[model samples]
Structures are given as structure tokens and as C-alpha cells.
Target chain A: MVPLLEFRNVAVDAAGSEPIEGVSFAIAAGENAVFFGVEGSGLKTVAPLVLGLEEPSGGDVLHRGGTIRGLDYLERLRYKNAIGYLHGDYGLISSLTVEQNISLRLEYYSEYLPEEITAITERLMAELRIIDKRTARPVQLTRSEIFRTAYARAVVHDPELLIIEFAFVDQSPLNIRSFMDVLKARGADPAKSVIFMTYEPQKFVDFADTFIMLYNGRIVFSGSRQDFFDSDNPYLVQYRSTSLRGPMAIS
Target chain B: MMDDERKTTPSGGSVAAYVGAPLLRVWRGTVDFAAYVVSIVLSFRSLRFIRLRSISATILTQTRFTGIDALPFVIVIAVLVGGVVIIQGMTNLPRFGIEGYFSNLMVIIIARELGPLVTALIVITRSGTAIATEIATQKWSREILALEIAGIDPRLYIVIPRIVAFSLSIFSLIIFFDTAAFLGGYLISLATLYMPVGAFFGNLSQAFSMKDLLATIVKSMMFGVLIPLISYYYGMMPRSKSEIPIYVSRAVSRTLFTIIVLNVLVSALLYFSWLE
Candidate 1:
């Protein structure tokens, strides 16, 4: 099957920083790929780029085989509807109530008046198990509640490709499964692709179909999860040495 | 020797990397601000419903921003200025033995120049800067982008309301300032100068003219539009993720500069158009 998204020779540079140079990666229609990198690495750039918030300095980001560029409002809206982004920090609004926040993505597609918004938000609130906090703002919610609310907002529209950053925990396998189950319940297609960026490999190792390693803004490895686990190449050795988990897990 | 060379090379590389990117970002920000303005105009036509919704919200929300919140400072400044003007007019008039000219001078200067200009200046410093900072922070947070992503144009939603609200606020403050200054002048005349009430009232009416009134309104309206536009332009211009904080200062400087230039132009126009 054709890839849902492709980042061809993706090169990004931010103000006061060197270019995150020459990175290439793709996510097929039904794959979940996670980028494992050390702290302060350039993986954060991928989250905003995928969401179309920042135009790449030197690269083509193809959505469904067409170069993502110069789309009119309706077409751009269509693309955004299919893609859900949770960019760690740039993902949620704090002043709006939980219901208002969750309904933000859905408000574009549907002509939701106050009543309609309230009804749909109430449903999502219940499903996410934060119903009592419907009127409460994001600042009032705990960190985990904020993440869950952000996740609820991302999936409330039922996006096909879900991109997450700084999520998943190495110490909580059951929690990871529970979270994936919640996503599945929310109509996130088991066949739809997911790209998560983080430092912890074991956190996402069970859920990810492919593992891509980024070092110094360069992709040093791209392969199946098993190949990543099984590789003893010098780059992989170096990654293992730096990782919190010194020994790679065999599935 | 190799170690020394390695440290120097990395340090130099870091410095070059840091300096090079921001200069390019400033160029990018200029281009981006232009594109945003153009896109705003285009999208204004395309998204009427969203614009209407935002406009209504802006009208309702800005009552506080423009009216009630701005009241106290507007009154205080106008009153203090009126007192200063009367005291000076009284002092200077006695020297010329034309003490009666004090009320005429007070009404003409306050209505023609001081009232509208002072009101606009206060609103620009207090509310205009706040509006710019608010919009800039919204840009930084991706709230503005969220509106765009949702097919809603931000200019109508964000900037137009501010323009309208600021216009209303400045106009109202000018009206209030004119009233306060008159009262202030009257109170001073009665308490200090022992000027008769009927004479003061007669002088105030004689000094008032249709041209002076029109000039004041036009200048105030121009200022209302100028403050918000300059603030929004500078606030929304910076795209660099790091330079977001600099937007506040840039907004202030740009607004102040634009307002001063506009004030000079309006004053020249008033002098040429009305006096001649």
C-alpha cells in the first residue's frame, strides 16, 4: 500500500540553531513509526512540520502522494481533518473549558451551535472519563488530564493519521496498551499510520511497527522493529550505549 | 594542540550557527508579514460567516476593553490637563491684562488639539500595547493558526475587532475628555480666578467652531485605526520561535513611531486645511 505521508530529504533549521540536515522517512498507510533520540535533539521539528504549522526550509512533505502546497481553505481543511497532531507544547489551549477545547477540531467541519457543541463535548468528556471537568479550564486539570483532553481533542474528529510527541512511558506497558485501546475505541484505524517522537524506545517499542533512530538531526537507521532490536551495527551500538536501556529487548 | 584546535573549531561553529540563522529569520519574517496581510484580505472575502461571528464577539467583548476599563485614566488626565491649561492661561493673561481671553484660549486648545490627542495617546499606551501583546501571544500559541487551519481568517476575527473597539474607545474617551476638561476649566475659573459663570460660558461657546470639531474627530479616528494596525502588524510579523518575546517591544516602538508620524501629518493637514 502507498504511504499516507512521506518526508523526502526533510531539512529544517530554526532561528539560532544549525540546520537539522538531510532527514528522509515515510509512514505507510497502516504503520506506526517512532523516532527515538536523546534529549534536546531535533525530533521536535517533525511534530510541527507534519501538522503544516511550519513550512520546511528544504524538503517536500507529501500527503497522499501530492506535494503539500498551495491548497485553498477547503482543501487544507480536508487535509487537517484527516491528520491529528499533539505537539507536546503547541497542542492545546488553556483558557477554554475542557469541552470547548475538545470541540475545537470538530467545530470546523460541523456547524455546531452552542447546543451542538455542548452535546458532542459532553459525549467526548464522558468517553475520556473527564465528564465532571467539562466546565473546568485546562489550567485546572492535572498534567495527565491535560494529555488525555488533548488526545480526546485530536481524535474527536476521528483523524486517520495520529501524530504524537513526548507521549508513552517505558515503565508502563499496561498503560500504553490501555491508551492504544482507547485510541482504537475512538475509531483510530488499526491500519492507519502513527508517528510518535520521543527519547524512550521501550516506551513505544511494543506499539511501534517501525523504529527510526535520529542522531544529530540525521536519520542513522530506518527498519522494522525486529531489525532495530536485532541490529548490532556500530550506530545501533552507540544508541544502545546512550539509551536508558543498555541492552536491546528481543521480542 | 589538536585538543585546542578541536575546542576552538566547535566554539566558532556554534557562534557562526547562532548568528547566521536569525538574520535569515528576520528576512523570512518580513516576507511572512506581507503574505499574512495579503492572505488576510483575500480570506476576508472567502470566510464571511466566521468573520461575522468574530465581529459580533469582538463588539460584545470590546465594550470592557474600550469603554469601562479605559474610563478612569481618561478622566484623570483630561481634568489635570484642563487645570494646567487654565492656570497657565490665567498667569499669562494677567500679564497681558487680557484675563478674559483665558476661557477662550482654554476651550480652543482643549477642543482642537489637547482632548483628542491626549485621549488617543492614553489609549495607545494602555490598550493598544495590550492588544498587540495579546495577539502576538496568540500567534505564538498557535491559536491564530488553529483559526486558519479551521478555514477561518484571523484578520477579521482578530485585527478588525480590535480596530473597531479601539475606535469606539478612543472616540468615547475624547467625548469624556472634552466634558471633563470643560468642567475642570470651569471649576478653576470659579475657585481661583473669581471669573463670573456667564462670561466663562459665553467665551467657551464663541471659541467652538465646526472646523475645530471636525478636525478633532478625524484625528481621533485616524489614531484609532493607526494604533491597532501598527500593533497587529509588528506583533504578528515575528515568525521565529525564539524571537516571540521581542514582538511586544517591536509592537510598542512601531505603534509609537506610526502614531507620532500620523500626529504630525494630521496636525499639518489641520493647520493647512482649516486655518487657511
Candidate 2:
């Protein structure tokens, strides 16, 4: 069976910086892949490529064995609708209230009645504990509220593939655990595939089935969780010890 | 290295380069804007697929902001202009032994020229800058990407509503401005010049032709389209937060320039039959 998502020798060029070169990976259905990279490691670029927001400068990004680079307008829309993306910057529309932002997709595309959309939105808002801030604009919300709101919007439709970038980096341990629990509950569906691009690998070690580490735009390691823990890769060693001295330069 | 480069560079080449670069950029910008307009036109086909409820809500909000909220200011400008035109015409036309054409002068100045132009100026100052800044902010915040992720086309949701609202709002505002100007002109003349209300209205009725009304409509519609298109084009060009203000300033300047040009073009076309 084809993997749910695949990156085939994908090389993305960044202006005035190192380019992500000769990268290859895949995630099968129901598998969880966590990507950990230092800041400026070009990990953030992967999300836009997968979301079709940016095309790869070389190679291809395949969604279920089909190239996603140049799908026509309707095909692109359909592809996007199947994936749930939580952007690193918390991409919430400032003009819209939290409730409006959450229900935007449903109100626009879903065949559900208005009452049903409201009900679903309410449930998600309540789950994320942002029900009280439903009527507030994004500018009025705290950073945590913004993250929760973005998270709720991303998962509101229960998409097949969920790609979350740089989420929960600054959240309390309790909040991260709670969000992980929510992710765990969602993962029980068996067909859900998740790719998390983050800076903190240790925080998600328990949740990830596969761990991929990048240094200076190249994958330093990719393996199962058990192998990841057992390996003596210098980057892994550096990460585990939280040491300042390592092969991977801090800057 | 700097001295070597400077030694190799010719003064004439530098002058040509300095002049050619901006001209090339302007040419490129014109081509890009033309392409953007074409894309907007093409995206209209997808309007049928978009939800009408969402479109209507956006249009309503835009109309309230652009048209309804502008009423008091528009009224003030109209009254002042109307009174001044009447006062000037009364003082001057009689010297030419053409005092009977006061109403014609009013129609020519207010309805044919100032109504649409003033309304457009107001809109460009008020709504055009707001739309550009809002879209630029949304882009800087990654909200446009968010819409794409959610499978909603920004063209349909953002651009179309603003286009429809600006057009409708400008059209209505021009009509309101003309009416208020005529009424204000008549009242000012009645109080100061002692002109009979019947004669004032009768002359105006004769002077106000269907062509004047057509001119106002045409100008408003054209201004409406130009403002939003220019604003959105600039708004979507910025790549960073610091660039938002620069892009917005460009949007305002471009919208103002385009509206004035379009107004003049429409007026000349109607009056001189230049296209014919």
C-alpha cells in the first residue's frame, strides 16, 4: 500500500541560507512522524511544501503516490480540504471572532445545517476550553488562547492528514500533556496520519512512532522510537544531554 | 573591490541605469496589475460555488463601513459645495445676463462633476486605505494562507465582496450626494437670493438631463472597480510586516490616481463622445 504522504529527494532552496537537500521520507496511514530541527534548519519550509503553499524547487511531494505540485485549482482545493494544518504563527484571521474563525470551513463547504455547524463549533470550542472567548477577536486573545483556537480550527473537520508546525513549544507541561491526550484520542481513528514539525523532540517522543532529526537542512537521523532512543548519534546524544558542546553547532 | 567596480562603471551607464530601472519597474508593475485584474475576472466563475450567505455578510459589513458610516461627512461636503456653487452662479451669471441658467450651472458642476469625484475621493481616503491595510495585515499574519489551508479561495471570499460593496456603496453615495447638493443649493438660494422655490426646481428639472445621471452612474461604477482592485493588488504584494505600511501607502496613492484618471476618462467619453 502507498504511504499517506511521501517526500522524494525534496530539495528546497532558502535565500541567503542553507537549502534542504536530498531529503526523503514517508509516513504510512495511522503512523505518527515527528520532525525535530533547530531554528533555521529549514524544517518550517516542509509544511508549506506539503500544504501546496510553496512548490519544491526540486523533486516532488507526493500525497498518496500522486504529485501535489501542479494539481489544477479544483484538485488543489480538494487536496487541501483533506489535510488539517496548524501553522507555526497561529494563522487566525484577525477580523473574525474565535467562533467565526472556527466555523469558517464548515459554514463555507460542509453540507451541514447552520444549527449543526454551530453545534459542532461549540463542541470543539468547549473541548479546547475557549468557549468563553468565542466572541473575541484574535487580537484580544492571549498567546495560549490563540494556540488553542488554531488547534481547534485545525482539527474541527477531522481531516485525514494533520500537519502541525511548531505548536506547544512554549505551553506548560500540563497543557502539552492535555493536547497530547487530545491527539491520542484523535489517533484512535486508525486512518489519521500526523506529521509534527517541532523544535522539541523530547516532548513528543512518547507520542511519535518515528523520529526524524535535521541539522543544517539535512536529516541527521531517521528511525523508529526505539532505535532513536538506543542510537549513539552525536545529535541524539547532544539532544538527550541538553549539552552546549556538540557536533551540531548552536548557531 | 569597490574602487575596481567604480572604475569599471561608466557615468553614462550609471545615469541610464538609474533612469531605466524605475521605468522597468513601472512597466513590470503595470503588466502584473493587468494580470491580477484578469485573474480576478477569471475567479468570478467560482462565485457560484461560494456560499451566498457568507458573501452577503461580507458585503453588508463593507457597505456599513464604506457607505453608511460616510453619510454625515458626505452630507457636509455636499451642502457646502452646493451653497458655494449657487452663491457663485447667482453673483456671476446675472453679470453675463444668464441668471436663468443657474440651475444648469448647478447640474453641470454638482451632478456631472463633483458628485462622483467627491464620493470617490471620500471612498479612496476612507475604505480604500482600510481594505489595503486589512489585507496586508492578514497576509503578514498568514491568514490568507490559512484560508487556502481551509480550502476557501481568497479571491471569492475577500476580493469579490469588497468589489461588490465598493461599487454599490459608491453608486448609492453619488446619488445621495447629488440629491443633497440640489436640495442644499435650492435652500441656500431661497434664503439669500430670494429665488422662488417653484422657479428654482423648475429650472433644475429642465437642466438635469438623463445624460447627467448616466455620467454619475458610469463614473461611480468605474471608480468603485478601480479602488478595490488597486488596493488589493498592493495589499497582497508585501512579504513582511514592515512592508505593510509601504504597500498600503502605495495602494492609497495608486487608487487615488486611478480613480481620478477613470473619472476624467468617463467624463470625456460622455461629454466629447471621444470614443465615438
Candidate 3:
């Protein structure tokens, strides 16, 4: 079967920074890929590229063996609707309450009755533990609450693919684990693929089947979970090290 | 000799730059605005894809904000303006023994001119700035991107509802302004000029024409479309927080200028019998 998403020798050029050169990856349906890198390693570009928000400077971003570059209006809309994105900033509409924000996509696209939309939205909000804050605006919600609300909005439509920017950097490991558990429970579809972009690899080690490490806009390592931990590549070693000093330059 | 040559060359370049830059910007802006209008028009095809419930909810919310909330202010302005115009017409027209023409003056100023223009000004100052700032904030927060990611077209979800609301609100507000202004004029005449109610009603009915009504409708609708479209265009241009205020200001100023120009163009066309 064709992979659900693929990046074939993708190179993205950024102004005032190094180009993300020669990046290649493929993710089959049901497979979860985790991308980790230090700040400014071009990991942030991956989400936008896949979302078709930004075109790669070179190479193709394919969705199911087809190029997503030049599709017409309706085709593009269909492609966008098939995927869910949890932005790093949460991307909640400030004017709307949490409930409105969560139900917005479903109500807009689905043929579901109003009652059915509400029921589905309420279910997701409850599962995400944001039901209590359903009436509150984004300004009133805490950081984690915002994340949960955004996550609910993303998955409310049961998208075929979910691309998440792991924003639990300051949270504890237990909180991260619990969030991961919720994600797994909600997004357990065998045909649904996920791409997790994070700086903290250990927290998602158990969740992702494939690991890809990026350094200075290039893939330093891409392999199975075991191979990722076992590799002694200088960049991987540096990443694993707690010290600031390493073969990889911090700046 | 070399210094003089350099000075002359630089001066010539500066002259060309000063003249060429603004011309280029105007050309680019016109092209961009045309493209934006086309995209919005094209997005109408996808309206069926959007849920009717969603579209109606958005339009209702926008109308409430743009029209309902603005009622008190619009009434106040209309009343005051109408009283002033009537006071002036009464004070001067009777001196020339043409006071019978007071109703014509009222129809020309209140119905045809002030109704649409004042309402348009009110909307530009209120809803227009709000739309610009709101869209800028949404863009800044990536809410627009979120909508796109959810496969909800911002044009359908955000722009169309707003355009519809702005148009409807301005159209309704113009009617309200005209009614309130006439009422204010009558009250002013009753209190100060002792003009009989029957006489006022007779004069107004005789002065009013289909042409006046047509002018008011055409101007109000034109202003309505231009205000939101211009504001949204500017709102979508800013990429950063610091640029929000600047773009909002530009949106307001440009919208104000466009409304004035369109108002004149419409009036001139009507005057020249080019439009009915």
C-alpha cells in the first residue's frame, strides 16, 4: 500500500538561516512518526510543509502517493479536511468559546444533525477533561486547558491524519504520559496516521514506532525506536547528553 | 567635477524614485484589490458546501454587532443633523419666499445625501475598524490558519458573513437615518417654526420621488460593499502584532476615502442622468 504521507528529499530554504536540505521520510497508514530536534533545527517547518501552508523550496510533499502541490480548489479543500493539525500556539479563536471552537469544524463540514454535532463535541470535550471549561473563552483557559481544547477541536472531525506540535515541554512526565494515553485512546484507528513534532523524544518514545532526528535542517537519524536509542552518532549522542557542550553547536 | 556629476545623478534618481514608487504602489494595490474581489466572488460557488446553519449564525452575530448595537448612535446623529438642516432651510428659504421648497431641500439633503453618507461614516468608524483589528488579531493568533486546517474556508466562514452583514446593516441604517431625520425635522418645525403637521406631510410627500429612493439605495449598498471589503483587505496584510494598528489605520483611512469618492461618483452619475 502507498504510504499515507511522504517527504522525498525535501529541502526548505529559510531567510537568514540554513536550508533544511536533503530531508527524506515516508509514513504508512497506522504508523506514527516522531521528529525531534533542538530549537531552530527546521522541525517547525515540517508541520507547515505537510499542511501545505508553505511549499518546500525543493522536492515533493505527497499525500497518498499524489502531490499536494497544485491541486485545484476543491481538491485542496478535501486534502486539508482529511488532516487535523494541533498548532504549537493552540490556534483557538479568541472570540469563540471552547465549545464553539471545538464544534466549529464538525458543524461546518459534516452532514450530521445539530444534535449529533453537539453530542460528538460534548463527548470529545468530556474525554479531553475540558467539558467544565466549555463555556470559557481561550483567554480564561490555562495553557494545558487550551492545549486540550485545541486537541479536541483537531480530533472532533475524526480526521484521517493528525499532525501535532508537542507543546508539553514544561509539563511533567506524568502529565505528558497521561496526555499521550488520551491521544492513543482517542486516535487508535489502524488507518489513521500521526506525526508528532517534539523536542522531548523520551516522553514520546513509547508512542511512536519510527524516530527521525533532525539537526541543522537535515535528518541526522531515521530508524526504529530501538535503533534510535542504540545509535552512537555524534549528533544523537549530543542530543542525549545533558551538558551544553557537544559536537553539535548550540547556537 | 566628479562631485557635481554624482550630485546631479543622485538628484535625478531621487526624483524618479519619489514619483515612481507611489505610482507602482497604486498599481499593485489596484491589482491586488481586484484579485481579492475575484477570489471572494469565486468563493460564492463553495457556499453550498458550507452548512447553512453556520453561515446564518455568523451573519446574525455580525448583524447584531454592526447594526443593532449601532442603533442609538445612528438615531442621535440623524436627529441632530436633520434638525440643523431643517432649521437652516426654514430660517433662509422663507426670506426668499421659497419656503415651499423646504421639503425639496430636505429630500435632497436628508434622504439622498445624509442618509447614506452619515450611515456609511458611522459604519466605517465602528464596524470597519473592528473588522480590520479583529481579522488582524485572528491572523496574528493563527486562528485563520486553524480554520484553514479544519477545511473551513475563511472566505466562506469569515468574509462572506461579514460582507453580507455590512451590506444589510448599512442598507437598513440608511432607512432608519432617513426616518429619524424626517421625524426630527418635523419636531423642530413644530416647536420653533410653528409649521402645521399637515403642511409638513404634504410637502414631504410631494417632494419625495422614486429617484431619491433609488439614489439612497444605490449609495448605501455601494458603501456597504466597499467598507467591509477594504477593511478585510488591509486586515489580512499585517503579519505581526506591531503592524496591526498600522494596517487598521490604513484600512480606516482608505475606506473613508473610498466611500467619499463613491458617494460623489454616484451622485454625479445621478445628476448627469447616467444612472436612475
> Which of the CAPRI classes, incorrect, acceptable, medium or high, describes model 3?
medium
State the lDDT of candidate 2 residue by residue for A64-178, as single tens digits. Answer: 9999976877788778877999866888988889999998888776677889888999998887788999999999997788888998899888788998888775667665445
| TM-score of candidate 2's A chain against the true A chain | 0.92
Q: Estimated TM-score per prediction?
A: 0.76, 0.93, 0.94
For each candidate, what's the DockQ? Answer: 0.14, 0.64, 0.75
The CAPRI classification for model 2 reads as: medium
User: Model 1 over residues A1-251: C-alpha lDDT tens digits?
Assistant: 55788899988887744356787877887778888766545677776777776778888888888777777766776788788766555445554678767876455345667676668777776776788888888778766676677777766766778887775432244433444667654334565777888876756666678888776777777778788778886567767667445433222
Report residue A137 deviation for candidate 2 (angstroms).
1.7
User: What are the runs in model 3 whose C-alpha is more than 4 Å off?
Assistant: A14-18, A170-178, A186-188, B1-13, B273-276
* Residue A90, candidate 3: alpha-carbon lDDT: 83
Candidate 2, residue B154: CA error in Å?
1.7
Cα lDDT of model 3 overall?
A: 0.86
Per-residue lDDT of model 3, residues A138-169, tens digit only = 99987778888888888888878889896664
Least accurate stretch of 10 residues (summed lDDT) in model 3 chain A?
A169-178
> Over 4 Å off in model 2, which ranges?
A14-18, A175-178, B1-20, B273-276
* Every model's TM-score on chain B: 0.79, 0.90, 0.92
Model 1 regions lying over 4 Å from their true place: A9-25, A28-30, A39-42, A54-59, A104-110, A167-181, A184-192, A216-220, A224-251, B1-51, B54-59, B90-104, B132-157, B194-213, B233-250, B271-276
Q: What are the lDDT figures for the candidates, one per model?
A: 0.71, 0.85, 0.86
In TM-score terms, which candidate is top?
Answer: 3
Residue A208: error of model 3 in Å? 1.1
Candidate 1 residue lDDT tens string, B86-164: 7778778899998767766776678777887788778777877777777777778776765655444567666777777
Candidate 2 residue-wise lDDT, B179-230, digit = tens:
8888887787667777877888898889988888788778877887788888
